[model samples]
Target chain A: MNGKEFWIYLAILAGSTYLIRAIPFAAVQKKISNVYVRSFLYYIPYTVLSAMTFPAALYATGNVVSAAAGLGVGMVFAVMKKGLTVVALISCVTVFVTDLILKQGI
Target chain B: MKQFLRGVRNGVPIGLGYLSVSFTFGIMAVSAGFSWWQAVLISMTTLTSAGQLAGINIMTVPGQYAEMLISQLTINIRYSFMSVSLSQLTTAEFKGIKRWLLGFFMTDEIFAVAACQREVSTKFFAGLAVMPYIGWTLGTLAGSLLGNVLPESVMNALCIAIYGMFVAIVAPDAKESRSLLAVVAVSVGLSCLFYYTPILKELSSGLAISVCAVVAALLGAFLFPVKEEASHER
Candidate 1:
């Protein structure tokens, strides 16, 4: 908690995190030949993002209705192949507006 | 150089999204009595929102280094999986020190964006990592220094920014291929099952996500193995 101890703690924390990312990345060189492994790797991105997004996104804005409004808007733009900034900014705006509508009871 | 600039451009939105999240992190850390520099240091070094948040909770007065170690490892194990996936996307010579340096910044956003590339170059990956680091550190400094300048509702709204970007990355890919659609759907279904069911709900967020990703991807691999020509197709 003090200045001195903070450095050590940060080192341990950062060191642990760095190793997790570094080791696997360094280990897996040359192309993976196995079909199952290759396919699994290919699908990892989509699956991880999907799992992280759902349900969690629903609760992100603290209000389910507003969050869903944001998520729906984001999904619409994303499916349209809009850029990341466009989709994300639109979602934020949607959440803000939805929260206003809910609070004002309009 | 062009690739590097392109990476920087692609990183801009991610950096913007990070500003909100790290700002909240800054507010929380300062409110907890830690100084602003401490929060900035954590963001700079660890570069993981959930892991750093967990670290803060575990870092009591006495400092449970053992507990912090385990908790951080648990929360960030997915990065290991992500790194392995990314390794396949890099050039043959991208190894040794470069792996350690770049892997240090391999947050979910950077990984998603980098993976979208056919192959990641060192310059490009380094450039992609730059702004998020600046945004994360600067945002924390601002939040810690300024306190709650942003409205609560506005801060809450910004919460969706990262997730929106995630959908932006994955949805179009899913649209391109039914197998990917199945993977996303199955992952989401399993994720909800873990999130909602009483017993499974107790699983930590990181573990729950890993389980969903691996199981769904495994099923995808078995049922819909890609032909050799399309193995690297995304």
Candidate 2:
């Protein structure tokens, strides 16, 4: 796109993004007095993150084996209470290596 | 001075992480025919994995405005929750303009770090925010400019950074409670369902994953409610 078109496109994109982000703050500013709504809001992040991470780790490459390997390594490290950096390294390395070996028939 | 150093120290790992993931985003944007400046600009504004991913998807599909909006909205809806949760964590003095300014810097990594702190001055948090903000923006610029230099395998490896970040976030909480274990388990299970179920496969990946997480978390919470601590006598 040219400069004018690009700017227009970006403006719309930025506006939409800012709107979504600004909504909760806007709602709070309005002084919504609902305890149940507030409680639901508190749990949204944990649920959203879980949903994002879970499925991909499970069905990567259409095979349970690879997913299992990744999850296994991740869970073990997680259970051992390793730090985020450590668990991430172990899980990814495990999946990458296992995927390589499985693909190579080694 | 000390706060600035602490910001720098905390920011280094996150900055390194951003370099890897944002590089992939940069490369993807360039490959999709976005200009270097455009890619950099997008990174500067969004500074989010899901948002960037959605942006790429929208760019790829010509004239799909509705699809693009929904895609971006779904992916970013989590931020609303992050914002709400974090609102409580801020000090009473951080009302009005300061809250809005701090809101801009509210991100998953920043929130995780801030949540762990017992009590920190808003100035320290602001200082902390500046480093990652600059690092993420610069990382994207560098990545966009350096497009296609790295091999695909290396790029694939870099995608693991977010997962690493998640592991870091969940590890502390998981260690502390069995209930959190249920949350993780249910999340994994729900993810599997979305991946394997043929009908659900038609839904967008972002939506599928997000729905699974919300459902799993609600189910887990209901099944294993957190027990209240014993009340102390007045």
Candidate 3:
């Protein structure tokens, strides 16, 4: 892709993304007062994170086995109260080693 | 300045997590034949994983600009929900420019950390956004320049790093609160249902995530409504 058309498409991509994000900031300047609505809003970050994790995490590597291995290790570290970076690095390392060992046919 | 530094401290981990994820994106965009600078540009401007991934596909073919707009909108719509939630968390401190700037940079991990805070000051959010933005762009630079030299196993392993960060963020809280646990379970279940069922599986990832999140949140709000004093507020 090149020329004016390419940049135009790029603008479309960037502009739409920016608008989707920026509109809410521009629109919702006040805290919501309803208990149910507030609670739902409060719960969104967690639910969104959770929905993004499972099944997707299981498919993140060469195969579900290694991915699940990483997820299992991640769960252990998370349960141990490790911070975000630690859990992520540990999980990455686990998948790395598991994939390596599996590759070695041992 | 102290608060800004604290935000930076909190953001460093998110920045580190972003490196692996954006490294993957960098490798992908380069391997797909886009210029390294173009890959970096996409990362810098878009600041989204799923959306950028979709945009790469859209841009690969010439004259797919219509698809470009549609895919970006479909893939990134989740940010609207996140931003609305974040608006409630922000204090009166953020003004037009800061909020607009922050909106441009908002990503999943940044939202996770920022929304957890009792107050989100402009400087703090700015501090939090900086490293992830830098790491994202630099990681793309590295990946496009060096991804093939890196082993496939390592790349595959690194791909899981962001998901690991998600687990890290969500697990401890779920462990503490039964309501949160229920919400997580419901979301995971719906995610699987959407992933595996024939018709349901056809839903785009952005839409699927939004549906699962909204449904799970509804479960929590209706079943275990939080006290007004309980949720984060300034």
What do the candidate models score in CA lDDT, each in turn?
Answer: 0.88, 0.62, 0.86
lDDT tens readout by residue for model 1, A1-106: 5877787788888999999989898888778888888888888888888999888889989999999999898889998999899999999999999999999999
Better of 2 and 3 by lDDT: 3
Tens digits of lDDT, candidate 2, B69-128:
677777666566666655544555555666665666666677655554443356767776
Q: What lDDT score is found at residue B41 in candidate 3?
A: 84
Mark the 10 consecutive residues where model 1 chain A has the least summed lDDT: A1-10
- Residues A16-55 of candidate 2 have per-residue lDDT tens digits of 6666555554345432234434333334445555555665
* Model 1 RMSD, rounded to 1 decimal: 1.3
Residue B158 lDDT (model 3): 83
- Sort the candidates on DockQ, descending order: 1, 3, 2
TM-score of chain A for candidate 1?
0.95
> What is the number of backbone collisions in each predicted candidate, taken in the order shown?
0, 4, 0
Poorly placed runs, candidate 2 (over 4 Å) = A26-43, A57-82, A86-106, B1-8, B60-67, B112-121, B220-234
Residue-level lDDT for B230 in candidate 1: 72
Which ten contiguous residues of candidate 1 chain B have the minimum total lDDT?
B54-63
lDDT by residue (B83-147, candidate 3, tens digit) is: 98899888798857778878997788899989878888988888888888888988988988888
Q: Which of the numbered candidates is closest to the native, going by highest TM-score?
A: 1
What iRMS does model 3 reach? Answer: 1.3
Higher-ranked by lDDT: 1 or 2 = 1
